[model samples]
Target: MSNLIPTGRTDIEWRNESTQKPPKAAVYPAEANADKILKAAYEHTATVWTGDFHNAKQVLAAMKKRVKRPSEKKRAGGGDAVAERSRNIQTAFHAHRMKQAQQSRILNMLAVEIGAGFTLDIPRAPDVKAALADVYGKPNDAPFLLPLNQLLGFIGAHEWHKKGVEIPALGGRIHVPFGVFSPLRGEYLDLIAAALAGSKFQTAFDIGTGSGIIAALLAKHGVPKITATDTNPRAVACACANFCRLDLDNIVIEKTDLFPAGCADLIVCNPPWLPAKPSSAVEAALYDPESRMLEGFLNGAAAHLNDGGEVWLVMSDLAEHLHLREQDFLPQCFQTASLEIAEVLQTRPKHAKAADENDPLAFARGREVTSLYRLKKAV
Candidate 1:
């Protein structure tokens, strides 16, 4: 039997000690299986073993393509194409959920096996046990089971950590820990760097500092002191780890909802680009339902800025192009917050998704642009 218990704010713990074990981890059942689950998993995780972080993403994309289409052709004699597509989508969703659940159970079982090795003085499972410890922060003996997908994700992130991403603008390679947000977009950083260069302030505040990249960039560019804040525990850990790695511990990393009560000469925020509900916790990068982060930054920025101070807001107009948000509402927001726009620096996205013509939102993405706006609190 499995016992459900609350562990952390974001995760639940499942303790299963019954003789009847949980389901086996789902894998491609056979080499000849049409779904090719094993092949996909191997390819997606190969970079993890090799320390090529970027390539792992490419492999995952390829795997997505394999399971994309429905088995029945559109021309098959089975109802309208739209209905068939919907049915196929529902089927796919169920299968994906089941696979994820089974995989989680399997990994839980593996964790138990690793724990037993340590408990019974078994000698052969050191590597697997050690890897699990490295990622989970505990030996296999712990009565908690992590989701298999999450375990795989951590393993992949560890590989990326080993490789490390370089930020030329900051003149440093930032070591992002497993499960931290990596700075994949350079154009945004360029805009931020430019904004920092143009600003006259010496002190700055970074809101929602995921990996503290922006704060680090500001510090690297000669900002004397910076207060970087994040609400997520993982992000806070990530920021601290990155700051220590870059030797920027002088830039204080704090766990706060947004601002930590003080005024700075400059305040900077890079909120999520779209105002949509995130599909998963990891998708926070692309979604900010109701524009919570953006609105909070704007509303509270004035109070946290010194008189004549500036707030630099970096965001993309893709949401507007998608008809998900009003394009003209940003200026209105500033007006409501009693702030005035000082200057706007814009840049085009360089990611392949922006240029891929086959993308569902290609038409909108091609015309999309990211901007860095410097706003000042009214006198």
Candidate 2:
């Protein structure tokens, strides 16, 4: 039980969810020192294997308490320097990301094994077969190592997927699958609904439609025809499942990046807000990595618009506040795309993070404004 069997062929080819190179793991019992585990993880990028479910949780927690964040006062030279650095949004943003990345690296070092048939052999371990199937499909013939933290995330996502997210605008819930972007924040959905209210389009396109919430919203708004597209096969499946649940037969779900073929009178896109690389598959919905998706949508939207049509670009200004993107960037993109901004609908974020003083990015979140840019071909 100490050894993790590979999912395929030889036991040497151990698999992890991230698909990154497997870390060298050493079995650590419940009595293992958390400080020593942290030191090993940091120094050698080693993984800790434990069979005690509760002990793994406790040890991971202990390891977290031992992990040190860079001392802001020491790094900033103390006193007014620390306060000045805190006020500098860009500096604080990068520091926050770095700290988060480091913490994740150390914490993910704690791992657990799943046996064949998706079994958790540890005492007091909850059955995760169903949740594992939800994301990874049927179990492989062999066992694999999974980060305990990521397993917890999978369990939580399973619960959320079971319960589904309540979207008041759709008058129902949207079941977000594991690794798909959940619509925890409803402000953006409200903006979409408000934009479509009392309006009719012959045809519509929902770009990068994760979980098909926006496409469902469009269908609910009485759009006669709609095309929803996503680059992720999981998202495409998620969207298709959601469309079926909503009985939205008119909308077509396609596995394509950004936009589908043909033109539409109305095209709605809620691109990733930040201009940064995503560390994980889920973060793809949050970070755009050099604004590639945003630029693609803007650059390609014009060619996919019918006469007298409008393209609605939904985004947030949080990146601007963080200095990740310049304030004039979108305007410049619009100019280059030869699209005229007809109207800009804006709303302040009401999420808890927006008001949480303890949040590292609170400065940017507090000033964040989500907007729906209604654009048209320049006359």
Clashes of each: 0, 0
Q: What TM-score against the true fold does each predicted structure earn?
A: 0.71, 0.91
- lDDT by residue for model 1 (109-200), tens: 32221134323122321244433443445454443443333445556676677677888898887766654567888898999887767556
Clashing pairs in 1: none
lDDT of 2 by residue, 1-379 (tens): 1234332224532444542445554454445667777776676444545556787788787887677555632453434554565577787888788778777767776677678988888878999998888888878687776778888889999999989999998999999978899998888889888988899798999999988999999999999999999998889989998898889899998888877889999999999999887777888999998899999999999999999999999999999989989889999999999899999889999888888665666556878999989999999
Candidate 2 wrongly placed segments (more than 4 Å): 1-21, 28-30, 45-48, 68-83
RMSD of each: 8.8, 3.5
Pairs that collide in candidate 2 are none
Worst 10 residues of 1 by lDDT: 44-53
Q: Look at candidate 2 and tell me the lDDT of residue 142.
A: 74
